[model samples]
Target: MKIAINGFGRIGRTILRQILTTARGSGIQVLCINDIAEPEMCAYLFQYDSTFGPFPGQVALETGALVVDGRRIPLHQQANVTALDLSGADVLLDCTGIARSTDLAERGLSAGATKVLISGPSPAAEATVVYGVNTKDIKGARIVSNASCTTNAVAALVQLVDQVAGIDSGHMTTIHCYTNSQPMVDAPRGDFARSRGGAQSMVPTTTSAMHLIDVVLPHLRGRISGAAVRVPTASVSAVDLVARLNTPLAEADLMVALRAAADRSPVLGWTDQPLVSSDLRARPESLVIAAPETRIVDSRQLRIFGWYDNEWGFSARMLDVAAKMAEAD
Candidate 1:
């Protein structure tokens, strides 16, 4: 699968790193990159990422190209989608966060992409997929949205519990790390709370995951609702989910059932280690259940906590989805 990244921010850079390391020789390769920054800045940022440490391999800048591991991927500084040369790319991964319309997204196809997989939620997407949970529902859509990071984390767990224990209703609060969307210090942005500082406070906000989950898990349409709290952190996030199950059970029993399901799941992970969010900074799993933190109250009330490196996990899944789209194409 040939990939073209449209943004070179946290998500975009990490996607390239995953392709070079964990996804190496897996038939997925980055063919080109498009960003507003110059090629020199792109190479510098990719080489020394403060969150994930160094790139591990060499990253050098050439004329209009970024060299990684001795391979030069063509780099384009095109702010307009029509100017991007995705000549041989099978999938154009839109990490720009601005491709919110079908007209903007479809322009990639005209530029040469066989399919366009958006990194964030898009009203224009023919399908909003959560990869491991609802990849089977893709059905060969030409334009697909991978949905949000929180959506991917929560949806996987929700499906697992609903299938294993049966969920009557649930609520999720993603203790997510602040993203580029928020400001570093107080500023006059559109939203009131978001105007206050991203790293300066624990700002409460809404998440689109609640709505996207319904698209991925249709039966649980009205069964689940979600919100998010942006904490002061660079990477790694947690999901604090509470559910009322149809069948009541002990805490131990629920753990056993969920673990078994995660064992069979593609993106879900299981970790019993006593660790904090910093420990999971670079974890590739979509959601790793912190076993000991899970508890049951009144036999029916369930609380579960799962961790994820939001940037890395989402990037990994996007690549996986892009590959699936390529196969169907």
Candidate 2:
């Protein structure tokens, strides 16, 4: 499987590193990378990630090609998706986040790519997949979107709870870490609150996790609401989820269900040990349930807290989705 990366930001680089290290035997190859950044800058960023530490393998640029651990991949400085040569790519991972329309997404297909996977939520996606929750529904879809980190975190727990006790209604509050979208210093922008310095304050913002969740779990449409606040942090975020259940469940029973789900699903993780947000860095699972923070009230309402390394975990799931799509082909 020849993969082409459309963006070289945090998620794009993470996915490249992940493929170089783990997907070697799966026949997955990163044939080319497309980004607006200069080749040297992208190579530099790939070699040194502040959040994930230095790259496990060396990276070098040779004749306008990127050599990662001895594999030379072409680097293209192109921003227009339709203008690129994608004849050899089996999958094009659009980590750009800017391609939100069906017309934009079709550019990859029109350019001769077999499939295109968007790294984040998009209205143009044929199907929005959450690895553990709804990947079974992605049967050879040409365009797929791996919702968002928050959606992945919330959907895993919600699906587990719904399977065990049945959810009546729910709400999720994601205490998220700052992203590249936020400004480092106060600046003029359309959204006044987000334009403020990101590292200096906690800013409440809207999240599309709820709507994307409905895309994956259509049965839960209009049953969930969500909000997010970006805090001053480089990595790790928490999701505070509350759900009302139709079937009453004991706390112990809920724990048992979560443990079973964790064992069965690759995307769900359960931890009883006391852990802070920093403890979850580099974790590949979509969400790690903080068992210590699990609580139930009157055997009907449930509260669960989950921690996720948004960039790493979400990118990992994107690779998983890409691999699954490859298999389907």
lDDT of 2 by residue, 2-98 (tens): 8899999999998987877764326787878988999999999999999989998878998778998888999988878777889888889999988
Candidate 2 colliding pairs: none
Candidate 1 lDDT, tens digit per residue, 99-149? 898888897898988899999999999899998898976777989999999
**How do the predictions measure up, each by TM-score?**
0.97, 0.96
Please give the RMSD to the true structure for each candidate, in Å. Answer: 1.2, 1.5
Report how far off residue 272 is in candidate 1 (Å). Answer: 1.1
Best by TM-score: 1
Native-referenced Cα lDDT, model 2: 0.88
C-alpha lDDT of candidate 1 relative to the true structure? 0.89
- Model 2 TM-score, all chains together: 0.96
